[model samples]
Target: MHLIHRPDIVASEITPPDVYLDRRRFIGQAAAGAAVLAAGGLLDPRAARAATAPREKLIGVKKSAWTVPEALTPYQDVTTYNNYYEFGTDKADPSENAHTLKTRPWTVRIEGECAKPATFAIEDILKIAPLEERVYRMRCVEAWSMVIPWVGYPLSELLKKVEPTGSAKFVEFSTLADPQTMPGVRGRVLQWPYVEGLRIDEAMHPLTLLTLGVYGEVLPNQNGAPVRLVVPWKYGFKSAKSIVRIRLVDKMPVSAWNRAQPSEYGFFSNVNPEVDHPRWSQAKERRIGEFRKRDTLMFNGYADQVASLYSGMDLRKWF
Candidate 1:
């Protein structure tokens, strides 16, 4: 991603002001050559900036059938249209309001049912698994979509290192909640410290990605910078952003949306055209930056890789 000095930067030249942070962060991190993006299916954490990254970091990254050759969604649309309720309910609120968030000096609190339950700085987290780029389709529960190129390593690599106990049935993740930095947190929109959870097998699936960045740049402040979860097959909301903690447990964990309105949002929010939302049909979705509606695919077209994970389970009931 190209860096610019001011918020009034031309949309054609660099990321928008609200999406991009101050120039000092770019210059300082760039000079150090440590700012790198990670992939999977989540937003990246800028606080987890890399001061030093391997030159050939992308060498191991590979393209899968899941990747479509579609041109990427414009940087402007992707940054402006968002649903980070922590920032605001409107799509543009995050871009317009998330500038004050400080990503540096970040720490991930890892706990619950793991052999290694220790806090990890962003740098140390990236070290556990080599970074790789994955271009995946992001299907939101609202039936909107985008194709974002994310950079990060497989979550399995880290989970393996942490070693979950046999009794662990689910994994829970929480986003940062700093009212001082994020203006929207002060409102009772959904819940403070947005939380999302995944079943143990789902979390361990090879397709699950711990996103560190988007479009090959350290995630912009509005895009859940620092760290987020990115599960391609599930609705975008399942990929919680600005993560601060993770936990392993035996019971199904409650998520923000599901907790607020379980009838509308289910814990196993896998993308399925057949299963319509209570208010709308899920058979089709609006791709961001495009006018035409596209037929929704089951598991966002990742059925081949993750279909078996829910083999005999009743998707409708679980959803």
Candidate 2:
């Protein structure tokens, strides 16, 4: 039995499933079930959401053991519904306004460690690497979740070229700065330029991705456009969008969310249902589109694979 992630369903709002399976069977059965329901005039909202969703490829350097089906929610449903605006309202509205902006001639400045610290043109980066597809469950700080079919490669592969120094302990990421291109940059909602950081170990995690595109197409100008990071373990905000700079450092660089409210966002923003955010409960999340609620799983349902990394530390504090 295969397990497919259906992002359009409001998982938390629904009753828990009686059984679990691998990606293939889950998606196939769910689709079949939804088809039957639709014929009977009882349609699954998620199925409707999936009906409008774009198909994307989740790539990996090699075929992943954890690959799931290509089921996706709509791009507007995903991007436009985002709560990641650094300088404006963190709702879906900012994304609609963002479409008017242009995204090109972008440059990603790479610094810290390595023999060569240089800024690579967006065209050069895309040309150098081929994209692959990988289906990953995306957990957010807001206690909501989604599964994304991301087209990209392991961030570690790119980091290898930069070469970190022995003293480097963390990697700091900075998003694009042009208010002309990003209207959100105009306000002081965040720190002007959004910033995120990851420990050396976290950055090298197999799940950490350097994404280029999604939904079997080039990234929409509003959806980070050129490149971005997709760290499934951390909350979505920690995965800085429209990235423009990456700086390697020996100390922990201050991040936007952490700086805004240290208690809300931590350096290690791993999803822990037990560790509730100040404004919300992390124990359960309301999956988008679906009216039902679902119970939150440890590490957003990846605890079996990643829990060992936090064996002794206090997740309640760090989260």
Candidate 3:
């Protein structure tokens, strides 16, 4: 297997805003360096950014304040790859095919615990909570990763308007399932109407996001079009794409993955290098690039900020 190199960027050595390195030129150098490192097997997996990275870089507005987490940076190297499919199924197809998906007339359904069940247009959501660009690592259960600069807002900000009742213990997320536009659903890889869930606390976590776009552009249909969820700490599947509904529930709603593989897909799918998946060891994952492999970080390197949320619970059993 071809092993990719971890992007080698020191926090202190970040390029200042005043110095603009041509993206085209930088891409060439990075590619050549990755090839050399892969051939020589000189890649240092431990060279990933410090786990407790500065908050400014993770959630900063400008690229200068942003230093991508190692697990996600290599995504830029392989432009043709991504897990999103409302755009199309081929790993490299979404970015190109997603343009065909129209996002207008989209509305999010709010149901379950709130006193008033409401359906609001996508435009109204932007008014509810303004968007912010958050660059985060997206780790997949398949052992591949990406560093995405997402455009979204805190889920909590929107949840507040729904006014989830005291009994609301978990939030259920559902994706749009239109066979006419989303041809992938026609396949049987997963049950129709992809679904995901999160505990009320996790859904409300400061890091959790209700993403609508990426890289300073409206979301490409393949990248979950109208809207999606981004939970950096968990495996990518937990973040449902092309979201259509946000239901406040009292119990753990059945998630698509958990329903498909009860033992393998847990409710709390946080990244844990020590706890191996039944089918594979997640100790390391490949970042999208010219053969760069890096050690997986605990909580996808957000443990310091999120560990306290599950203080007394047994994570191993939860998995």
Candidate 4:
């Protein structure tokens, strides 16, 4: 769905933080007692704490043509209800524990089949391109969804700076795994330095975002601070968080999830309602903040933009 421009309105005029926070606090309190009754237990009391987290305003965030017209999921829900396994398995664990993460002095290493291989500081990465706010529908494999206002430029902008060789057919992303800060990493989850990958074309797609912030603010530690990948068409897991390294390779790199459960998680994890996860149905999803369930869409409603990438391939098989 394309975004409708409202020249009369601006980012600052969107929903006020206090209003949303108060509403979120009420819901969080109510959910604590009625956890099983609220959106199948997706709501948590820890989400209320997200309102207290400090955030800096992001300036010069231009609206993008790729945004959807859906109402945004509240910032509290977006920040607290996350699947960052590096922090912990519970949805609220990231928000509660990710405060230990240190974002500064961060550098993302670019290597492999790229000729201009170099490491870039977080500051340099932010300066690579002007930021744009793209409101995208994020569908998780667990049959949940959210409309997040992601602020960043296209991933292709950064990839171009590295100058990938002709043989660079895939792009692999690696996330930080510091046991001292990220307590969950000390245990055997999937693997250290969580890895995810995409085809060269997918990596270069205009919809593929190298995200830096959300809700017109610097990214929260729980929500992949410093840098992250956001592929809206694919399931949320495809968007690796707290990224530290990007590699260009000739063959498909094994992703953390795919390696952990090859039968359930595929290499190309496009949001296909037709392909069900081993334990759950992918036909419907509960959008955060809403009570009713909505039918899951092909490519999470971005089929018009990304379906052609898999024209001849069997998504069920590839999935």
Q: Which candidate is the best by TM-score?
A: 4
Cα lDDT tens digits for candidate 3, 17-93: 44435776677756766866776633532222112211222223334233364444532332346666544556655
| lDDT per residue (tens digit) for residues 87-113 in model 2 | 257564445556654557788888986
How badly does each model clash, as a count of residue pairs? Answer: 18, 24, 9, 0
Model 4 agreement with the true structure over 230-293: per-residue lDDT tens digits: 9999999999999999999999999999999999999999999999999999999999989999
Residue 314 displacement (Å), model 1:
1.6
What lDDT does each candidate get?
0.81, 0.73, 0.76, 0.92
By lDDT, the best candidate is 4
- The lowest-lDDT stretch of 10 consecutive residues in candidate 1 is 48-57
> Any runs in candidate 3 off by more than 4 Å, and if so which?
1-79, 85-89, 96-100, 290-292
71-114 per-residue lDDT for model 1 (tens digits)? 78886677778888888898877876777778888988878998
Residue 34 of model 4, lDDT score: 75
If ranked by TM-score, best first, what sequence of candidates would result? 4, 1, 2, 3
Residue 315 in model 3: shift from native, Å?
Answer: 1.7
Error of 3 at 253 (Å): 1.0
Model 1 deviation from native, Cα RMSD in Å: 11.0
The better candidate by lDDT, 1 or 3, is 1
Give residue 137's error in model 1 in angstroms.
0.4
Best of the two (3, 4) by lDDT: 4
